[model samples]
Target: MLNQDVLRNARSPGRGFAAAKRGFDIAVALLALPAVLGVAAVLLLLNPIANRGPLFFVQARMGRNCKRFTIVKFRTMSAGQPEGGPAPRGPDDPVEDERITPLGRMLRRARIDELPQFFNVLSGDMSVIGPRPDVWDHAIHYLDSVPGYRARHTLRPGITGLAQVRGGYAEGIRATVQKTREDLAYIDGLSPRMELYILLRTVQVVFTGKGAR
Candidate 1:
């Protein structure tokens, strides 16, 4: 059965794992705050020269069970839209494309751009590990187009996850379907060991810049 004890709300499959997972997320987030915030602070100081943009890129995102919440991240793009339109749908998430500054690109590759999201994790708006949250607009599109996409939100969104490690940045609808499958798989296969494995893989991805934009 799906885990009824979500973080302050609904979560997905597994009996007692939901509560345990939230606890782990909280513990990790607490432990990580000092270092992560320090790095973010350092980056904030350097943003003028390297990034030349706002300190953060805040946006509404789809969280567990389709709940909307604001997700915060280090700004990787300029203050406005890349152009007068929405970020395009195809080709490896155009949100990360031409609009992204070079330093922003580096931040994304290193996963440093998302460090501020630890705050989101602490706020119960996210998780330490689970399906990564999608931007509200894009997530709306996927909900209509991709099968099982809604089910992927069975748990709080994560900073990193199986889809992020295995599937990387999913592009269009086909890739999103794959991402949804991995998300559901992660939900179904919840365990301390599995969570640990994902966390370790996240470390590797951070250092090696593999499977990152």
Candidate 2:
């Protein structure tokens, strides 16, 4: 059974919180623009030799209200893996996939691959902090398999979020359920204080390479 508190907290926020969150997203995105761009520029120079694929990997992700949006990340996989290989086994599974280049491993470990999503945040497709978006395929599978899974889509997806920091990559239906709980908890407890906490944790995750895949 669902916890009433979780359900209550997961409800869409009032207009004030929504507005404040948007303001915060804009402020943080703007503040981080220089660094994000700098890294992207550096990666552009290095990636051709390092990874030997397109500079950016663009894929459709389920965003707020389950809308589809294209998310950008540095291409971390080798060029031309045949489509329709087995579904990704888990979130962290990609870290071990043979297609990942050595340099891609380093970038994933440093969380540098995700820097491109700052553009998504700036474009209003995402926030600096919230539930991370899922690829459309995973989103569809989980929507059917995981109860209350759709709840996480009520707000804009985040570049980093409670699930990424706390649970890392969810590997299966059970793990995805746990991640949903964390995400709902975050929504229930949304505030400047919590936002700040997630931001600090994100920095720690990035630097320590605690949960990158």
| TM-score of each prediction | 0.86, 0.89
Clashes of 2: 0
Compute the lDDT of residue 64 as modeled in candidate 1.
89
lDDT, candidate 1, residue 121? Answer: 91
Best by lDDT: 2
In the range 131-205, model 2's lDDT, one tens digit per residue, is: 988767778788877777788888899999988998786665677788888888888888778888988998998
**Model 1, range 29-105, lDDT digits (tens) per residue?**
89988988788788878888987767876788899889999988888776675321234543334444777778888
Off by over 4 Å in 2: 1-4, 82-96
Provide the lowest-lDDT 10-residue window in model 1: 1-10
For residue 137, give model 2's deviation from the true position in Å. Answer: 0.9
